[model samples]
Target: MKGKWHSSWLLLLIAVVLVLSACSSGNNSSSSADNKEEATSSGEPQDGGELKVGLSANPKTLDPILYTGVYESQIMRQVADTLVVYNKELSDFIPSLAKEWKVSEDMKVYTFTLRDDVYFQPGEYQDGRQMTAEDVKYSLERSAKESAMNRLRGVEKVEVTGEFEVEVHIGTPNAALLAMLTDSGNIIVPKEEVEGWGDQFGSHLVGTGPFQIKDWQKDSEVKLTRHDKYWGEKPHLDGVSFKIISDPNMMTNALRSGDLDVGTDIKGQNRELIKTDQNLELLSKPALSLTYLDLNNKKGPTADPKVREAIYKATNVEEIVKGVNQWGGAEPSFMGLPKQSWGYSKDLEKLKPTFDPEAAKKLLAEAGYPDGFKTELYLSEARVPYGTIFQNQMKENLNVDVELKVVEWGTYSDTVAKGNAPMSIGGWTWYPDPYFFLYQLFHTDQIGALGNGKGYSNPEVDSLLERAVSETVDQNERAKLYQQALEIILKDVPRIELDNLEASAGINKKVQGYDVSSDFSIIIVSPNGTNVWMKQ
Candidate 1:
């Protein structure tokens, strides 16, 4: 009887083990099925869709070297690739066409190694060909010789050292060269296409980039198709089309109706409208751009330093900025450099002129204008708001009579460029480097269309700016020189600093990984676009 009972107990233990194994297997199967379902529902990058983008203005040209406006760069950048790409902050660089590069100890010579895999997109002028050092040398030399912007003026020559290596020699040590190379003008172009197309090259563009120009219908739209043989991680979108919608309201409406995937330059109430909409998102990044009032330093009432100082003291910049950017797209600025700049000095904020109408009256009286004189504030249509606010402030604070002269953009820009406007509203947009802002806009040597339209000339300021560019690779030291220059410039009052603008875009929820560059550049298909994808 005892033996029989022990045998039965052993059989019962075996049966229990079998049942537990069966249940564990079933649970494991269920968990695996649930995980697969979750992944399918999650948002992931979908491939093979065309992205439609809306542009506020038509691009002037597609040629990288000859184009002067940001609108052109917006389209050219999609078709061309720069040697090195800078971050939105302009703090660092990443290799693009050139896989690697080295700067000499003296900082004059920049040697680059071309990436072996990059190939120019095929076009009407030539079949797609591998990009070599020859292409780099040709592109750089051509830009240095013929670029309208003179972006590569510092580059003396580009020499092809080997089949895949080249050297860019400059006459002087320039701290801004690396940052300058990131400009659209420096993108490598195929020699065959450029020579073949000649003067018509702007219409027939070719380059080594993720996208190839398919068609440009002037004021209608610019179409681009993906280059399947792109050297880098391929663009997820099959193509991109830039629809020219000159009116901001129409652009916003198109985005709302799902006719566009992205809308550039969304401003004012449009920004708020996008914010409230569940299907849209507003992407805004503080831009490296400024809108300021230029006080003519050559010949005018404003030429008097006392008068300029009085105007700076009388005007309330914060209130003006708030009024101009009523829908919230700008911040009041104190210095020439925008607050987003890496070299911008927080300490300089302490030096901003305090608004004191009483002190302004005293300065005006000392300058022989106790009763402020009437002057014309020249501006374009877009800047009428700034002009109105400033005109009102002068009248209210200094008992000054002001006239607002609103003209066409071309006339307004030409007047300011020639230093003809006694007081003009001018805007500048560039990289985050202080040299780009200070040297061009404040240096005496650049007293024309180059940028110094106010005729500002100070030998001490020029010396500081020159030293900042040639003295050191240490950015901290360069920043110190810039800071000293800013202090003197602030006191001189060449221009009344008003506000820094922000680049804002309206994007649909279907578009993923879209980024707004502070320099107002659009890079939707490159690495800078951050693996941008769209949902089906």
Candidate 2:
């Protein structure tokens, strides 16, 4: 009987073991199923990749604010992230580092609340630092003192309230001030590193951005590595390389050859080639930008307002837009800036800049250039948006004998600063603010043989601009004031209003999300984290 009982107990133990084994198998199956779903959703490819780009020329300076126009901004963009960034639609400014902001009742102070989860790009000395309010204070204060023309000059003080709060207290309310803050020229840099570098900091860049500057072969390539410790989403692409090739046709070649993922400041007949290519994609958008001839009112024939007007009437701005630029969207610039921007007065539309060659001839006769004058139009060999092509076409179309004095961009920059270049094609990257066109170009503070090439100063324009800065609360009201201001500048014709260029680009099929904008800020698509990645 004892033997029989022992055998029955052993059988019961065996049954319990079998039941436990089945339960374990079920759990293992569920865990395996979950992992498979996660892998599918994440879209993780077996290997990450690289993005190669074709650049128009080697950037002369990496200093964000000091450099103006398209090329420098494009390079600085990859290395830094601004407090406020322009939208993809180009309609307005959106929160970036500062998630939300508010203007004081008096409209003088702008207080910004930073998002909690933010980190700088990783460095060799440290892994990464969490973004703090002090960084915001550091960015604004240093930038203000760094230049004579900082928009922050209106800002009285910048203070940190807490770990993630910054207050920008202005001496007076400027409706257009906040919009200027969105420019890369006004980007916030890490204070600890930037205190003493001044202009030299352009070479050594640091920021709370998606990529870290790894290696630079000046004029050859600019290489950046993705930061795994990035606070936001990590880039899908492992790295990005900018190859300096000035020729637009060569840039197109790189894109078609599958060697370059992106190209910037693309224009002319090359534009038509990229748009028609089946293997690639085209991302084009109207930037808040306008190209105009900078007539030095400080010297020469342009000093006469009538000559400036006749020059305006004589130059075929519309033909340059339609003929020189093989692409379609570019329009003749009628106002100081594009019609889409704020402070854009329909007041300009009422006035006309028609193709009145006969009227221009009569005006020239009145200005004492009856047989047409001899003037050397200084042109930039910058390879930016086809400076050479535009200059050539413009010379042909103007029906006037004008000599071309083309110079390399680097040499031209120095020569222009010395007040040597007589008349050169200049451009303004219009931001969300109307003051960018009016104040910066015409302000007494910037007037120079070099900086303020136009040398246009009006006490009335200044008075209204001052009123817009000190008293206006509503943006639309400010826009109206700017419209009033625009009527004055356009009437004065300080510039030969040329083409309101449509920024064009050629993108390799692999570059999934990319585009060109008036601001010419490429980082907007990539953001600090989200936009970059490998497709498979």
Candidate 3:
């Protein structure tokens, strides 16, 4: 593990001057618009400073295109710029690298005008590698084959229109295209560095953002200095140092001891202890996190629908919301999708797995597990602050003996999402769209290694989600489509819908400029950590 290495922003990093074309100059929004930039509600403008962000788990890779989870994606968001960026608050999509774009009348082929000012950071590739229309083409084209982005390969064609523009001809009019662009994903990398980086690309990521990589030590720390060629507002902090320490208890202790400035996943399955700490401030709210227990159906003891029902009926989401998370922190849900997700049905929660022992035992008996079968529950540590809570609850409700397989983040992601493990535990951080959740978990035909253990197959559900995107219409119609999709998911029971956990952050009250929002979660700090300054 790499010990912490710190560098002052003012002294250690190059200050990037991102000169914007005048508002009328066909570039991004003007400097004034940039000033209005904020990370989320209560967040302020980008300033010069250094932020010490402590990560609970090490990053799989720094490559935005490859890393598929949380802080890793968020960190890449800071260091890269995509064609389209979600507004600082993630309320809407605004142009970033692509200066402007026009939707086709059919909405199937959207054309974008690239910005000439955008340039790749100087690296092994020669200096002044101006970002070209071809770079956009190559980047998106490469993403098609990317292991983490194979779902995106469905794209039909990417044509460079002109020196300043390109055209994306989709296989269909995907409503989720814009939403996907808003993901920390689709972050454009310099086409030059990608082909040769191999497995190292995730770690040696370089982008045209306000930040540039200084160094990264596996399972330890990653340091990013500022990128002066960046075309957007600069970061206030001189540099950012992210330290990876797995033990949640050690994480909280470090924050309380003032050894770390900020930490993620600061809870230890104990809310009261976190609430009483005076030295540290805990910042938490309804986050996009939703957990589940997946039953592998392709080849496993859980393949039987009766077994799936037995597990679901034995689960009580409401009991968990109270016994485990008491800070109004979670809602018992059989809602396959996140509560705030589009097409979330209040009625569906009732249809979703509920606390029905009778129904469960009946199914268990039919499945020949009259005396519930014992199985191992695989838990991903990168998920919630605690895995034992869900495991404990399972053992309590079903009277089924469960052995725990608590795995680290990287392998766990692949195991659960890629069908490597049966009856695995996982969570999805939803935002941009239901596709982020649905596209990953379902869609049996696409992306070979991905999908939550369950070989969930349903023509109706797949068609619904596919049509939801392929067809252009009002929001209400699309939502109805998703609800129908959820109906299929609920019935198939590939995963036992767990509760939607209300995300809370452990913030030191002293750290200023913490933007609190259920959608976006990035925060900034002042030089002294006394005042939380912002734009409006």
List TM-scores for all candidates, in order: 0.90, 0.76, 0.72
Report the lDDT tens digits of candidate 3 across residue range 1-536.
Answer: 13333344433343332223233356446645654553433454445555667786677876656776677875786677778765544445667788788788777787888888887777665564788888888777666556375535456778988987898887767777776665556777886677667667777787777677888888888888877777765455677777887887777777777666676764445345567888666766656677777778766668887788778787765665566565556766665577666556777665666678787888878888777667766775554433466567556666677777877867676776566566776666766467667766787664344454667877888888888777764457887888888877888777777667766666665456664446534544211122232222
Q: RMSD for each model, in Å, please? A: 4.3, 7.5, 13.8
Question: What tens digits encode model 1's per-residue C-alpha lDDT throughout 102-206?
Answer: 988898999998789888898776678888999989999999998888988889899999999999999999988888888899999998888888888888888
Better of 1 and 2 by lDDT: 1
Model 3 poorest ten-residue lDDT run: 525-534
Cα lDDT, all candidates: 0.87, 0.69, 0.67
Tens-digit lDDT track of model 2 for 1-536:
99999999999999999898887776997877677556545664323677887888777676665665467667677677778776665556678888988888898778899988877765433356777888888778766766535646677789899889988887767777677677667776776556456556777677776677888898788888876765555666787888888888889888888878887767767777888899777777666777777776767777888877776665666666666566675777777767657566665765645666678777767888777655656666542443444445434444455566777777666665555655777767667577776777765666754445667777777777777666775767777777777777777777777767676777876565555666666662354323755454
Clashes of 3: 16
Give the winner by TM-score: 1 or 2. 1
Q: What is the lDDT of candidate 2?
A: 0.69
Off by over 4 Å in 1: 1-43
